[model samples]
Target: MRRVLFAARSAVALHRLLDVVPVFAGDARIARCFTLVPGSDFGVDALAVVDALGGRVVPWEEACAGAYDLVVSASPKGELALLSGPHVLLPHGAGFSKTIRAEGSADSASGLDPVYLRRAPIALHAMAHPDQVARLRAAGTGAASRARVVGDPTLDRLLASRPLRDRYRAALGTGSRRLLVLTSTWGPESLLHRRPDLPAELAAELPYDEYQLALVVHPNEHSRLGAYDLAERLAPAFDAGLVLAAPREEWAAVLVAADALVTDHGSTALYFAGSAADDRPVVGVGSGGPELIPGSPMDELLRSVPVLGRGQEIRRALDAYRPGAARHAAEAAFAFPGRALERLRAELYGLLGLTPAAATSPRLLPSPAPARRMPAAFDVHAGLIPDGVRVARHPVGLAPAGHHLAVEYGAAGEQVTLSAGVLYRRPLPSGAGWTSGGWTRHALDSYPGCRTAGVVQPCGDGVLRFRGRELPYAVRIEARVEADGRVSAVDPAVAVSAAHVWVAGHRDWDGGRVVFNCLVGEREFRVRLREATEGEAGAAV
Candidate 1:
């Protein structure tokens, strides 16, 4: 059996190598040894990535000392030359569009940078397009002689997964909501770094039930910040219902699920644009376009893709979107296209000194739903409607700017602070539930600034619980005409906010029915509450 070493330097590099490893699956002739090469900041979660995939790992030092037929790596960084074998370098991104700068070195074309290539001498250099090979030759990088156009396996996998877009969206649980994805390469030029608060800002501007926002940050940032710190840093965005795709495995599926994209010069954006047929609009944020190689695919993309434009809200841009020249431009950077896996397999087999095995179709397995967090608290904004009011809500933790605050009672770390007024869930007094006004007075005494509180009963599950300060007894309420609807089973937090708004307008509001018009994006949900008797309260606690 021919020994092949899978040398991974970073999370991004490991992801790229993973695409190649699948090509050799079921080939008994090749024995694989995986090792994570240190000496780079892009190390966090790198080992976990391998463990998650169930790879057979060899210690880094032992693997370096051992003889191998082939040493396959996705990145040119790290001290790879110490390993004894014929080294092959794989491009981890969209054909190395970014100009890279090694530590204590000048800027140069990414893959063609002789300094890094010299440090990690490679026998084979896989290029995604002819333009890339030509660019390498122009850079005076002597290794250009070894570089060959083998197409992009990443893009190829994405093309193979295109038909599963509906499944991808369904997996993300994006119900009646347009999925919006924001991508960024690591560094100051990234979308997140440039506009640090963009995620929370977008989460606030876009209506909660209408838009689902996801982030696809590069693994370099993922490694440097560490997953825990990064997640904590983006805690606000998470609280505002941000879906975070893990650095490696989930981003492709997230891209497939997206209805729109907001990006910087990340390579994934270019890949997505190529596959999505310009059907989904992309709004480019920041001026990181020039950071890529001149006339490279990503550079051209930024030049043509719609700019977010200073002072223009992304929500407004998405509401009025137009297709850009992304597909035509991005397609030019890929050669062999759908046949990358086939062509790349032949190339690797030749390096490993083995006859190419019969080609078997490879497919990307359906990705799991990405990790997401729903807002536990919201600043509920309301305006007047016919009998009730029109309302909208924003996350209190991320971007608080509403008339009243609504917080999920008994939520983790539940801390009730004095705001204009707060809404929560509570158990109504046993015999005096919304009738004797005992629960309202009891709730007011317990939670400061709590103007509205609600409870759902087992029998009358989809009903409202409300009361007035001056009224002798509280009035039980049933959702008006919404017997079997989303709002009928309304969230206590949201429902209490509606009650809070209703009371402000109707302080002298005696018992009666009041309708609420809630705006979810451009659509309106009418939630009306008709008075119910104490008997119909159904022992709601």
Candidate 2:
């Protein structure tokens, strides 16, 4: 039997370690003890959590000096770093869309230290899935070699709570009123911080009779921002009938009870998207841009949902919300599904190099699962179609195909060109669910154009380009078809060096609009495209 130290530093780490401790309860091969970091703000709360779980908490020095065989921690930093024996790294959560899964860097807010893992002797690095391991390896994180797909215990809790949705809703007294819970993680760029008045604005606008609003902020908000500050900030929204949920409440309960979710870039969104508790609409506020890791289930959800770059879009999205492919994509990300606890227990015992005692329990350890294929390459789904471009009548490609546009750069300048034809995808069949659409090619001239708006500078008849010294250039084009049947002139698409980009348009009969919003780069540059009222075609060339 090995003596294990569960090191707690942050609130998130404590919550995660607690999930594992119970599964190994009364086991003979491992003896577990909890220890808190000296100055963690959540130490008192963590102690309460441990006491409730009937776990032992030893003093930090005593635990460290006890010569423990293994140290298991949510983070590799702090005491885990100081421990002499091999340690198992248990990161706080899954859903890597917001965090960088690469080797050297860690999610700044996640309390993990990949550098610590790189520095320490890691006996095992247990992740939610093999794809996660692959990403860490590609990022050059040294611990990838010791990584295993053990699944997440919290996910199991959420999955098991699925059938109790009604009970949780009743507890909230939410009767027939559609419940929408808004969650904002801690960060300056977090939605609540960015739009402090958002709840009041949403409450005042959304009909009180039909929908009830609730706010669940990250636990750090309570500690970092004092009660007076929180009360003062949230008072107006509370007065407007917004139910403020306690930060310590089980997130699974909230997810089970709520009909819809609104959040920014955080793990809460990932948890909701990845669970089967509900397939209701989840609207993400702010930043209608790419995720840190593109094409995961959560990433797919963000792309599919109407990510409101502006607050006004929130109401519009909710009015027309529906659960689509993102829900299924998210649900599929869980490798062990409802069996996380059992699977994780197996991984823990494997890490300790021991077999479980048969007399202890029949389900003590789960049989090893077959390796799952790594999730890769996000599908080209609906809702990402650009504004104001119509699919050509005789578009050549499959319903949902992808094409790469070429962008060539040189000391002279940069040139951008779209593929020669309109690569289009047809509407998915009714029962097809959320399968990836196949894209096919046709002539670029086949699609019709619409009236163009927004800032622009004219180039030739229908072309625009940007050339900035050492900066990646970006251009947005909106065009309206003129009476002469010519595609309204703003930008002609062509390919150049260094990078490849593409433009694909589909006919959206429902909205009577054309869409084109696909450009790959960190920064966007809008050309000063307005031509002088009367001049020799002078522009910001």
Which candidate number maximizes TM-score?
A: 1
- Per model, how many backbone clashes are there? 0, 42
Off by over 4 Å in 2: 28-30, 38-44, 51-54, 99-114, 226-229, 288-298, 309-313, 328-333, 357-541
Residue 448 in model 2: lDDT: 22
Estimate the lDDT of model 1: 0.70
Report the poorest 10 consecutive residues by lDDT, candidate 2.
434-443
What is candidate 1's lDDT per residue for 377-425, written digit by digit as tens?
7777776666555567777755557787766554524464445366444
lDDT of 2 by residue, 181-246 (tens): 888876565778877888866655553333567777776675577545775887756654566665
The estimated TM-scores of all candidates read: 0.82, 0.60
The all-Cα superposition gives candidate 2 an RMSD in Å to the true structure of 22.5
